[model samples]
Target: MKSEAQTPQPNDLQPEKDEHKDSYNNIETPATDAENSNIIDITALENQMRNLSIGFNLKWLDVNVLPRKVVFEIQHDVQQKILKPLEDVVNTMQTVGLLSMEAQTIFKKMFAMFDGTETEYKFIECLKSADLYVVPREFVISNELRPGVIHNEQGMDNDPITGILMPIKFQLRKYLESPLVFDTILDNLTPSQDGYIRSLVDGTIWQQRRAKIDCNIVIPLNFFFDDFTTKDTVSPHASRTSILGIYYYIPCLPGYILAKLANILVAGYMLSEDRKEYENEDLFSNLVHTLIDLEVNGLTISYNGTDVTVHFMLGFITGDNLGVAGILDLVESARANFYCRMCKRNREQREKDATEYEQTFRTIDGYENDLLLNDVSNTGVHKNSVFNQIPSYHVVLNVYFDLMHDLWEGVCMYGLSHCLNYFIKVKKMFSLNELNCRKNVFVFGSTNSSNIPNDIKDTNIIKSKIKMTASEIKTLITFFPLIIGMLIPEDDPVWSYFCNLLKLCHILMLREIHPKLLDTLKSLVETHHTQYQQLFNDTLKPKHHNIIHYASFILRSGTPRHQWAMRGEGKHRDAKQYSRVNNNNTNLCKSLSIKAGYKFAQNVYNSSFVTPQIDLSNSKILDYPSDITFNSFVAEKIRLLNNSVHFIDSFIKQGSTFSHGTIFYVTYCNIINIFELDCILKDKSNNLILVCSSIMCRRFDEHLQSYEVYKTQVPKLISNIGCYETHTINIHSVNDKLYFRFCNFNVTDKVIESLFVN
Candidate 1:
């Protein structure tokens, strides 16, 4: 509740005293003030130079580029020219030690051609081209036992055999004994340089140019294979074996160069200052002491092959190197002085706050009645006040020092210990409890939550909330955000965690809205899977008409009842039940039946709606067949009305609301249905045609009197029988097509004649 800024601490007086002393010293030397000032300026410059030297030294400890280049060049030359040629010579000599002059001459020529070229490729070519090529087995007869010798026979011969010589083995030994042979060969093929000339060139142009050197440092070949075998022997009976190649890169050069440069720079800087008499030599001395201290207290040194490399480059640069022993003394002294200063400051700050609080307390009328402060007589209770409490400043300072010590120890040990020590130190300085408190304050202040004191809260609530926290709010403010992130549409853990924190914070803070409101919203969205269903319906509604039309076409194209019996029956049941319950036998009943049928049919097509089946057996029932009517006049009227209902339902369900184009299309489609009735009449038998014509004429008179006919075509057949046979009418296709059948009817002569005469 208290402001962190109001909490004060003591200040050191030594800095002030030192300033006064310096002023006094200046006044005492009034005759040479300018000279004295110059001395101080020079001292400051020297101190800065010392610091820069230390920084560079630390950076150099990690890597060195200068020496690395030399090492790399040496390695590159050895691998490309020396190692490959030596390997080939060793392999060749093993098979043919003593050769005829002609063969030896040819061999030497081929070796010269391939020596520094693509050695592997040219060697393979030479072997294939050679007239007297031999594998290792053909050359050796006596298998003398030696450290690296290989034998396949049961016994060993102590003396050299007649035609046998180990070419690869002999050549390898020759090269090892005399490495100068390959070096000389490479020198003849490439450029030559003496040590003095190279040094001269390096001194003249090295610093002026940046060289980009690239090379694939080879891994040692010896490590890859244990032994090898030879085939195609001259005797066709002997065998041979030999060890494969041997190599590893030297990584010390780069680091070495870097350390050398650092030493040069640091030494140069120190010498430069020593040449001039700079004042405050103690500061530079302290810097030198710090470097020594870091080397001892911070740096970790290790050897790689022949070169020495130091870890913790920063530590080296920052170290006070008065010497290892002196560095420790400096650290101890600094730590003690820092701690004493902090402790004194905290005590002074506490006393100042206590005085202010006492002054403020006197202004309050019922200060004695208020229980804000403890009685001075009670030591235990009084100890709880800020005046008696140990300051957090000292605690934090101690933590920082401990952290530095741990970091030093970690660098010496290396690996996870170093990493863990760093993390622990960081956590100690920025405690999680304090972090949480700050987070809570930010959240409350931002949301304008009533739980936060108004006086402490900001007036521009919206803007304040926007700027309140840089970090995202926790998963505790609102339940809807959580539930929506979780179950309603899809699951997302990150979103859910965030929302949950927001909601939880909201509840804990007790804002204007109750927790129940969020719960209810979640419940509504979740209940009956309503949110999911609504989302699905809204997405699918526009496509519903097209789906229905496709389904109807598929059914009319001759799908058997058995294929869709369960689905059709379910749709019929839904239509009938919904009609019976909601319509109450009014005109709405007719409308409901049509709407329900349209909706049900749509669901059946979707394959998502529930299907009707026998509960116990899960068997489907077939849709009822339509019955034929003798009264053609009544049937025509019913057909016209059904067509209208179908058109309206389809139009309303598929068409976009408030669109004139949709309205026009619906009207046009309905008109087309009316014209279809006339086409049907023309195709019927004479007797039925007469009946259809009369019905159409009467309907036309009632509905189409005001409109002029664009084209009129009267059908040529008309006939009727007073008594007709009952027939079955199959509603094969609900939309676009229908089929019917007449059965058990006698065709009277008078009716047949009337149909022909008409």
Candidate 2:
């Protein structure tokens, strides 16, 4: 922990004449003629100040403190009054059209409310608080601000890219010491749920202790790096303001906690373009050295009144293809002969669908040899990466591909667009107008309502790009079969290709992929690729080639879903949001860091965990069910009525939400069974009991791409499976026949292996 130096706090109730005069100079007033300006208007100025003071309506404004402690208390109260509004002022500068200097002037006026006892400098001092203070540093010789909004007029070196390096060691220590985070990590050493063991710590390598853990406690860390545009792409300044954001998170935390922005820590940021490779390496050297030092001499932190040495290693690095290329210092061009960082395969071979040649993968020795070669075109290696400096990590093996970009945006988009074009344009199975109409009127399930894809435009279909976000593409592909399957024949080659692609996506996204499933996954990829090539007579893109390595990556790491850049990319939104609000282009990185520091400090001060809000006081309590073994089910049984069933509209556990009609799966009699949440119940100990109505799967509906299921004769009083992971299903009644379309097709296999399934 970093020790904070105690500075003397300002006494806001008392004003010094010199300080008040300085603050008065900061307020801007309209210039007037000498005669009007020279006239004495003290009474009017005093009345205007009094009117402005009325906004706070401070009752203590008239209090006369007789004791030192009372004066200190009043000063503290005044500081608290300014903090909230000051934060608002800082965050809303762009909305109100004020520059940094102008905002500083307004802050001066705000401080004047404390009887001008302090100046703007003192207020800034207070804002710095012991938590963190961000100051922008120049990375180029020109001493320009950030690259985009400013130009070097003095003809200095034009290589301008400002950078901000945060305190990583401090953040790591804080995370280790935080009870909310540390306790969760400890509790989740194994899978928190039955079949959802996707965290890095749960991987075979980590479980076998293949990696070194020489301290009393080990923290698994995952680092993410990516480039994002701060400005809209249509703007001329967009590329200039492009930023390379660095972020990190603990993989040991539950998936829900890891998804939260509060848990993701920002390491640093710098302008991405107009910078040399070595400069990027230099930016990461600080982080690299810090990790090495911590690994060598572990950080001892106080946890639960005991001190333990905490050590951490880089679990993996995740990013889009371009970002991964940059991190590994490989040739970034996807069109290059050796474009892939993981393996060496040229475009010609992939186009030919060649598999006879022995595969050559990138290795540490190969990387070094490639670095020595003068002409490195044949080899993808560009230069040495600073990430390889870690003790047991190598950029070649530890760096993983992001499934979001590779699958969702790349493969899914291409495959779906081509299939859609073939169906609507070539085969003429259905008109584009009809498909669009169906999509717009389709009723999505509750889980997928938020991620519905946008209307497919003519240009999107014509170009075979399927312009949509990663999430939108995933949703569209999952339900695409349902929307148009009735019109297409089951044996249609194009439809088969699309279905194979959809199945591949579902298997890749499984949280706990069985070892046997890897072979299935590999076969699915090959089958999908061959089917696409045969149907369209087109070559597979680089993403299709990249996915050939996913199953192997999953074995080395955990599931690809957990290691994807979806959440890490989300961290970029914070900077983007702050950019929109502050609009401090000159010191963009500095302002964002300061704002993030305040938010992080607030998180640290408050409880970082969100308690589940469940109140059933107004509902009636029912007796325990007669068939269910309540005593055997619960560890400690309590009396009924007090220890009874309390029905709730919904139940929230971890990050999953359960409600009536929500379908989930469990294991019974060594077979996979399905059930719907009938109602929620709570025992005297507040443990939830999930009363579900059983459903039986009849057959797989090929047209709907879902299990044809019907409700059982009676609702079963099942216990021990409440609040399990859920799967989405869109219940439909067409021509008096009911059908259920699963949001994901692989839910059955996952449920079978889950230990929680009973």
Worst lDDT window (10 residues) for model 1? 218-227
Clash count of each predicted structure: 49, 0
Q: For candidate 1, write residues 1-758 as lDDT tens digits.
A: 76756654464232343432465344443323444444445445444443333222222211222222333344346555875576567557645864333343434443333242233233224332321112222222234553433385555435432121122222222221232322322222211132111111112111111121121111000000011122223433223211111101111111111112111111101111111233212213333333333323332222222322221111111111111112122112222211111122122233122111222211112222322444422111111111111111111111001111111121111211211222223223333243334334433322224323221122222122212111122211221121111122224222232232232222222111222333432332123122222322322111111111211111111111111111211222332333333322213222332232223222222222211110112212222114323245445444554423211111111111111111111111012111111211211121122222111111111111111112123322222221221111111111222211111011211122233112
Per-prediction CA RMSD (Å):
47.0, 15.7
lDDT of 2 by residue, 20-126 (tens): 24454465453333433345354555445533443222222212222223333555676668655675666578466553544444454454554532432343344
Top lDDT hit? 2
TM-score versus the correct structure, for each prediction: 0.11, 0.75
RMSD to native, candidate 1: 47.0
C-alpha lDDT values of all predictions: 0.23, 0.65
Output the TM-score of candidate 2. Answer: 0.75
lDDT of 2 at 94: 46
